[model samples]
Target: MFIPYCISLYIIKGNKSIYDPAFRLFALNMGFADLEFMALVGIFPAVSYFLPFPVSFNVCKVFGAFSADAWFTCIMLSQMMSLNRFVGIFWPGNAKAIYTKRNTTITLAFCWIQGLIWTSFYLKPNVGLYFDSKNRGLIYDFRLNGTETVFSLNMIFNYVHASSLCLTYGLIYLKIRQDITEPYRLTIFHHFIPVHDKKDVSYEDNILEYKEIMAAPDLNTGWRRKHMLDPKLANDRKKENKVLIQACVICLLHVAAVATWAVSQKIATAKYVLFIPSIVGLFSSGSTGYLYILVNSTVRQKFASMVSKCWCHKANQLSNYEARKKDSGIQSISPKKDNEYSELMEMDDYENVTKN
Candidate 1:
């Protein structure tokens, strides 16, 4: 789901579908991070569950270290999302300046590297991980060791991050409310002087196209999303709010899921919540793509179009084969026709069939 949505978001232009290119990129990166966390944390557990691989404690530690990298990256990504929203709302003028492609790339790269740095702290004396039958996955346990301080500090770091995120969004919410009560406007004008001769000159006034960061609201719901007089402006506001709302919901779910997982780790009484621990990060990474598909109408149309095209292609192939048989009085074609993508995907299957 993440893979297809990521591809479609890029190929179909999601910002045009809803928000801007920056949010589209944000969603894409989040999906990629989810895939990263999934690969690091899910694969070994799944493989062990099915085949019972005798992985040594040292090997498990190595895998756990990689998963730790994903953990830290996720933490940093949450902070980035909060900051992105803050800038987009509070300092709309500087949103583009701050959320540039280069800056975003550099920020993500730094977070990943930071994850590696943070993962080092997790490499302690008594921490051990192993595949278990009870959970049907890896179980992480810490024996009597003085390294508990490091884990405690790590938890502190997460708390600080969460607090910062909440603070930023809270500020953004306040700003939104203020804009509703007190409307603000920005304007720009240009004056040009044209000289036809040395003694004669003409002055002309020009008005350049300008867009306000916040449009005035006539008065609406509890707060005020955007008061619309013109159809175009109304549509634009609706699109922006759709992306913002989806992002907010996804972020909230991600944090809640992670929080539950973290709590389950320390609280032995709620051990059944272990499932939440395993799936929260995975869900966080993949949730945005699903939200876009379900909520963003443009993305849905594109996805539906793609699906229809695929079915039509398959139907065409069957119809062509039938036509050939009818015209030539034959039963079948020597070889079936398939698109290049299909052929590439089926190459391994073809080889296996031949070997069988």
Candidate 2:
């Protein structure tokens, strides 16, 4: 958790130009969510569960409140990421204006503030989180009058996020497919027999043009993702596609974890079985860092550089410490030898005086 968080922070901070402005904002927020989830919710609670002493209810409540906040933040960010991809793909012309730095900044602020407001409900005495010893997990208690509304709202939010991801990704897939096939389909409508082809020599050329268009490689495996009309637009589209692919993989993991938790809640299961959902949720949160490192070449390179620097720094420190120790030992031994030499000279002087 710590390593990935650092790597992600480095990528976000050091490699700003690696992604779009909106994408950078989204990635930054997602990093914060992961940090909060891992620090406030994941590591502490997991460690607490294994301790010799039992954790107090109030402490559990506080932890659970923060956990819920992190969870909700992630859900909200996931939806925003989906929307960002959707707009970039469907409206490439206006994506730049729509997702300006100022706009993304405002959106991120709203997301965090919204999370805080939702988390306030969990702070109430009747509505907070508690650990269920039987289930060995943190269980939200929302049956009380005060918490029932919050519970419903949370459920509704989850459903909305899940639904948006599904709809947006579905459309995105269709749009990409359409783009790949449109060129070939349009080739059939072209004038197969040109007027100049009356010479018969040009007839062969027209046939070849039609065939060439038809034989164009599938965009899925082709070097170019789209039949780009302009080089700049093509580059932007390619970047958007890469961003979409990474975001989709991350969001899919989130959706799968949420779905698993929902199903686990519905089933009446054994005591230990309840732990599965929570475990899966943590896994989902933790896995994003690994995914980022694996998928983004820039991030991977930066992480490697950081690791190498740290090791080199440690090695240098160790060498310096050893050199200092050796110098001190030699200094101490030299003073002792000089004192012994002086004593031996005085003894030899005494023997010469006695002989005279």
TM-score of each: 0.67, 0.73
lDDT of 2 by residue, 131-205 (tens): 565676666564556665666677778877877888888899889777667753453424332425356566568
Write one digit per residue (lDDT tens) for candidate 1, span 174-276: 7766765555222111111121344533232111111111222221311122232233444444555665667667657656765865576676335455666
What is candidate 2's CA lDDT for residue 181? 76
Each candidate's number of clashing pairs is 0, 0
lDDT of each: 0.59, 0.69
Task: Enumerate residue pairs that collide in model 2.
Answer: none
Q: After superposition, which runs of candidate 1 have C-alpha atoms over 4 Å from their true positions? A: 1-21, 123-133, 144-147, 184-227, 268-273, 314-356
